[model samples]
Target: MTREESDMIDHRRLGRELDLFVSDPLAGAGLPIWLPAGAAARHAVEEYVRDLERRAGYQHVYSPPLGKRELFALSGHLGYFADDMFPPLRLSADDEFVLRPALCPHQLVYRARGRSYRELPLRIAELGGMYRAERSGVLGGLSRVRAISLNDAHNFCALDQVGEEVREILRLIREAHAALGVRPAGFRLSLRGPGEKYVGDDAQWARAEELLRAALDGVDFTEAPGEAAFYGPKIDIQIVDAAGRESTLSTVQLDFDKPERFDLSYTDASGARRRPVMVHRSLVGSMERLFAYLIEVHQGAFPPWYAPVQLVLLPVDAGQAGAAAELARRAVAAGLRAEVDAGGSLGARIRDAAHRRVPYVGVVGAREAADGSVSLRLRDGRSVAPMPVADALGLVGAVVAARSTDLLPAAA
Candidate 1:
């Protein structure tokens, strides 16, 4: 595909062309329908990140989509993020509930249930669908949406352990980005300024900002005063898209105020109770935004692990269909997402695979049938020497498993 064609295969176009997903104008606009392909992509992303989170010692937790209005009120969202919250849903029991705009408060309440200093640093993660109110103008495709599937998590750590936890989370984020091939550039430290725009005691804000700054001392960052959240300062990872737009991809925030507001405490080693510092971190942010950004960044050519179909088996004609199906089955059994493309001419089949951004294409024909071998083509049209079906599948599997795009020959 030419540069023009690549650009045209961006998020919006790919979402429509591949039938991966669609935003319905009639179904309250911002909500999107995840067709099979889109859902598969989301599922792959979730599984990948969930595995990483588990290895990083994060326990998975589930929370309700809506909670009492006072939940956010205690978390300070009612004052700071009221504009982004959905209006309260009045219950028949004469109570008020609002769709959760964030997952922090529910997790905090869970942490507050009871714990000793032995559980000093509790890491919990959730892949939650959260809703927030947004005006029609700001709602675009997945890039900017009112509803989001967030990879939200928080760590409640004793004050002394905060720095090491931040560093470990940063490493995890880097590993996740490396897997997706979208490594972040650097951090943006959001700090507080003296103003009525923020809440909380001035001394707490200063102390919290200083702690975060110290944590980020050696890291690269652009400090932005007056951009801090009302509860605390934060470090947002920023990335530049293919369209050259700079966006915050993920964040790690340090908060000293919420524990006080919620009256949270944990027993210390000295047998005394103490307030634990809270860190809110989301490596991929919302899946919705990340998918949109990745589509644009890679121009719809996803990496091997993330691609819907990593390989496709193309038969020369109906005569070779049986062998092609066998190869497809083998590819699937090898843990690769694959299918047989038995329609159209050889050139057309290869072109289709290229357009779909598949990493490998295996062509089976009479020669391969007779010799029990198959011709392999890197999604680029260059012909790889004919190899036994097992060998070809093994090579492709290795490439996918290692996420080594270099193993794929350049486009022809």
Candidate 2:
């Protein structure tokens, strides 16, 4: 589609029409509020990512969004990364607490205590909040937000285990992209460029770059000097927007600087203390940017699994209201998102459902209701013959469970 065509279906328009999110001036620029529908979808994605990390052996933790100014100083944010950070909130002359711009500092503190080789690969993950002081002119919808809820993680591993840990993170990124229907524009090896202010020395940078290169063995990527994080190099997964603009959607970075700065150490096999490497990675980036891309690419018809309302039951008249309500209750009991809309005419309700981008709409007439069945109407304009309510719900559940991109099960 042309850029104009894509722009017309941008997330800003779809978000308004679908009630996904809203940005009000009183709430300040760049801080968008998630409405109910958007909140439900975001919650689903958050649950999926947390579970994915847990199954991958990551221990989740909660961290505050504010920290002492000294914390960022230790993380090198004050030195090389102050432009994007908000001004420090001075509680007193010596007790300033600033909103965090990154989670690495907090993660490093988590590993501050003594550790052994057995915990070499301590994978810590969080779906937490951070704030960036983005310029007002750059703030638009959910794409560029001041407050970001990030899906961030940090892995502290021994030097020998860095290669495998980075590669495994790449695997997780690919799986998440497939499940979320994210089409990567390209992959990038972000590195330090000439005259750029960076934390590590030449030897450390070279070693980090080499490790990242080795990890991208079978993958196609381009070198993007000057795009790497202040501390080290990263593998950035890029996504194109409705305007054909490309931005990072996920990433895996190699960091040797943080461990040294934080003095993180682990006991080696020979009873010697050793420094561990910190690997920073985000499987799906931030929720705001993710939804921005998802809204535009899918045109608000999100995949069934993450769609706000999976099924809407429309009863033909008052007689079948009971039947529609019963099916909706059953769908909820089955851990599916469902609702009954009996306020409008059959045709009107169907059109409304289509406008809302509902995945499945079950139309209940007298005969179908009497049989405890429903004629399923899909969002793609396909209609199924009247089937048992249980069977209809099963089809949806199957697609959701498989995280299939298709609205229907593969066999169907």
Best by lDDT: 2
lDDT of 2 by residue, 120-220 (tens): 79999998899999998998899999999999999989989999999999999999989999999999999998775888899999999999999999999
Reference-based TM-score of each model: 0.92, 0.98
- Please list all clashing residue pairs in model 2, or write none if there are none: none
- What is each predicted model's overall lDDT from 0 to 1? 0.81, 0.93
Q: Please give, for residues 1-412, the per-residue lDDT of candidate 1 as tens digits.
A: 4567556846778778766689877877789878776787678789989989998889998889888888888877888889999899998676899898888878754454777889868888999978889898887778778888999888989989988898888888888888777767678999887777677787877777777777777788898888787788888898765555577888899888777887878989798989988899998989888988777777667777778887888888898899889888888888889999987799998888887777778888899977878887775556789999888887777777766545452431
| Candidate 1 ranges beyond 4 A from true positions | 1-10, 183-185, 407-412
Q: Give candidate 2 misplaced runs (Cα > 4 Å).
A: none
What RMSD does each model have against the real structure?
A: 2.9, 1.0
Q: What local lDDT does model 2 show for residue 107?
A: 88
* Candidate 1 worst ten-residue window by lDDT: 403-412
